[model samples]
Target: MKCISWNVNGIRAVLKKDFVEILYALDADIFCIQETKAQPDQIEVDCELYPYQYINSAQKKGYSGTMIFCKEEPLSIRYGMNMEEHDTEGRVITLEYPEYYVVTVYTPNSGDGLKRLDYRMEWDKAFSAYLKSLDKPVMACGDFNVANEEIDIKNPKTNHKNAGFTDEERNSFKENLLAYFVDTYRSLYPEKVEYSWWSYRFKAREKNAGWRIDYWLVSPELKDKIVDAKILTDIYGSDHCPVQLDIEV
Candidate 1:
């Protein structure tokens, strides 16, 4: 099966940009979107065919949010981890299938100047614990918001102090993924420098000043089932591109 994840930046804007066309182009069996930034009533898309959908929206209006659309019904659905500190942002959603748990997450950014670095770390720890507790096999995908390694970012030296490239944040990211799952992209195409996210200003996208902060991570047991994990770096309707994983589900 094919699963794709994208952070549309803002659902309303991308909708007008013909996100539905992009969605059709992808033709993924399942699609998860981050930063939807819209309540269901705010924006409408053709739903007769791609009808299976689940949304976890932030309590605050027009802020962080996520949604998943699938080809078929899920065995069960969960909105979040049920942690007050984590659920409020509406950054997580899990859909259980007969095979494994498919989770889509939008991790919190540490913010510029390290203002929220401490908070981000707390969130990282909690999120890691939650994933580990799943125990069952998992295929977790999303905008992690952290460039895990020097190879994951465009200019590592320049971005060292940036919110997503800090050493501390990278370490936390490693501890989390290394604990159980592997970054499928790195495992399959380690030397590739393609990126999924770029800044709107400063010609970041044009110059390829981007970061591979988005990912598809799978449990060790399912590692061999992964066929490919890639970034659709050229699809530019949003600041972030779509990332995907082809797995033997």
Candidate 2:
């Protein structure tokens, strides 16, 4: 199956761009989106290919949210981590199939000056535990909001203390998620340099100054099934481009 994950930044905004066109072009079996910034009622995707569409909107309007579009109906669907504090943001959505569970997450950003760093740390622990509790193998994807290693981000020296590149967040990601799951792209191509996200300022995308924050991570047992993982940098319409995963599952 082919699965694609992208942080659209805002669903409504991307819809005005190439969202629908890209959806048709990629033709993924499952398409996961993050940072929807819209309510369930507000999202109007015109694609007829995906009859099963699920959205997890935040309590606050036009805020962090996630959505998934699948051609086949899942056996079950779950929203959030079942933790009230974290669920309010509509950051997580899990779809359980017969073979495996597919989870899409919009991890909280630490915020300017790292004001929410403490809460982010707490979220990491809870999110990790939630994934571990799943009964079947998992294929989790989305904008994790953290660049795992120096190689994952451009100019690591200048971004050391930044929100997504901070040492604390990196360490937490390693201990929390990487310990249990395999990062598909990095696992397949350790030395490959590619990025999924780029700053909107200073022509960062044009200069190729970007960070590989978005990912497709799977359970260790599913690691060998990973056929191909890619960062579709050529695609546009959002600050973060789409990441694709091809697997037999």
Candidate 3:
């Protein structure tokens, strides 16, 4: 089955930009999105095929949030990491399918110049622990907000001091990938120079100056099942492209 993930940036905003058309084109078995920034009541998507709709929207308006639109119904669903503070921002939505679990996240951005770096580090710890606790194989996918390595970004040396490429942030992000499971994109095509998010500044998309901050992380148990992984770099909307994976059990 195909499991897809994207940071839509804003549900309300992307609709005008052909969000549904993109979703239909993907035609994934399960569709997950981050940075929706809106509640279900606040928006509407017309899709008869994928009847299951789940969302974890921030209590605050026009802020961080996530959602999963799936064709297959999950046996169970959960929101947040069981932490009150973390739930407020609506960052995580866990769907327990019969075969595997899917955790979609909109990991907090550390802000320019590492302004919110401390808070982001705390989130990393909490979020990583939450994923490990599941133990059940998971497809933890969405906007991770930190480019994993030098290959994941265009100009690594110049970006070292930047928010998404800083030593501290990169280390924090790197540690979790090591502890948890496999990074699907990096595993399947290690040599591919790809990116999932681009900056709005300086025609980053045009120059192809980007970061592989978004991901599709699979549990170690499912490592062998990952058939294909891709960053939909050619697709566009919200300055972030969709990352997709096809898994064969």
Runs of candidate 1 exceeding 4 Å displacement? 47-49
Sliding window of 10 residues with minimal summed lDDT for model 1: 40-49
Give the winner by TM-score.
2
Q: How would you encode candidate 2's per-residue C-alpha lDDT over 1-249 as one tens digit per residue? A: 999999999999999998999999999999999999999889999898799999999999999999999999999999998888889999999999999999999999999999999999999999999999999999999999999999999899999989999999999999999999999999999999999999999999999999999999999999889999999999999999999999998
Q: Write down the lDDT of every candidate, Cα atoms only.
A: 0.89, 0.96, 0.88
lDDT of 1 by residue, 1-249 (tens): 999999999888998887888888888998999999988677577744478988888888999999999988988999989788889988999988887999999999988789989988898888888888885799999999998888888899988888999989999898876677889999998788889999999999999999999999998999999988879887878999999999998
Deviation in Å, model 2, residue 61 alpha carbon: 0.8
**Candidate closest to the true structure, highest lDDT:** 2
Tens-digit per-residue lDDT, 17-101, candidate 3: 9989988888998899898888779878887758998988899998988989998788899999999878899999999977789
User: Which candidate, 2 or 3, would have the higher lDDT against the true structure?
Assistant: 2
Error of 3 at 171 (Å): 1.2
Clashing pairs in 2: none
| Number of backbone-clashing residue pairs for each candidate, in the order shown | 0, 0, 0
Which pairs in model 1 have colliding backbones?
A: none
